[model samples]
Target: MVSAVPECGGPGDLPAPRIVTDLAHGGRWTSLTAGGREWLWHRDEPRRAGVGPGDPFADAGGLEECVPTVRGTPDHGDAWSRPWRRAGEEESVDCPDFRLTRRVSAGAGRTVVDYRLTAAPGYRFLWAAHALLEVSGRARAVMTGG
Candidate 1:
């Protein structure tokens, strides 16, 4: 059975960007892919010590101020950052958390966005990469792991 994919998006701060931290996959970033190239949390590198699977991302950070942004460099940004650009005059959100505010540009035919997720009082969740790629169909045809 095919799931009802939300086409117009849900209740979120539209025209804005944010970090998407899901402890569901043990704090591992989930994904949203299209045209072979996809976007998700944690693309190799390293997972923050306490930011691994099952640990509530925001639950680790305190007072609603956790996570980080990755710009200037891949590791420079935080756990997750997704900017909600104007989607052709549409108002909808596909991301989870609505906290990311930084917007970086693309130079290598790829758009790199960085963001974060906070929990309680000093526990910050760390993430590495979530790239938006333009993979060819043939390449995507044999993809296996992340």
Candidate 2:
């Protein structure tokens, strides 16, 4: 499970479409089946401290430093290398100010993701959603929001 179209290839050149629901390697969300039950968390692993190989749609922080000369400007900003713009199931990544969109949909048991962030106003930024769900043996998680 690995749908590829993110761009600026590197992770083994990309494109591995078996097609159930796959988008691992940088824009990770590996698999999801819904009510029938097939939610196995993915891992090919390597790339530690900076985080796993499976990057469940990672986004570090935003608007970090760099305005003095402003060349590439990436310490932990710009949504991890930035190259996503697939329309249909929806996948977007842009950065002049901010525009990160991810949309995944499923039914039955539920696998719905609609993460969006569109900033470009006064530009005070701080975004966080580094998803890594690998629960096998003992699993218990309950999180609300603020």
Candidate 1, 99-121: lDDT as tens digits: 33333332233334434332456
Provide the TM-score for each candidate, comma-separated.
Answer: 0.23, 0.25
Name the runs in model 1 displaced over 4 angstroms. Answer: 1-5, 8-29, 33-49, 52-74, 79-134, 137-146
Cα error, candidate 2, residue 7 (Å)? 33
The candidate scoring highest on lDDT is: 2
Model 1 residue 90 lDDT? 23
lDDT of 2: 0.43
Candidate with maximal TM-score: 2
In model 2, where do residues sit more than 4 Å from their true spots? 1-31, 35-41, 48-77, 80-96, 99-109, 121-146
Give the Cα lDDT of each candidate.
0.31, 0.43
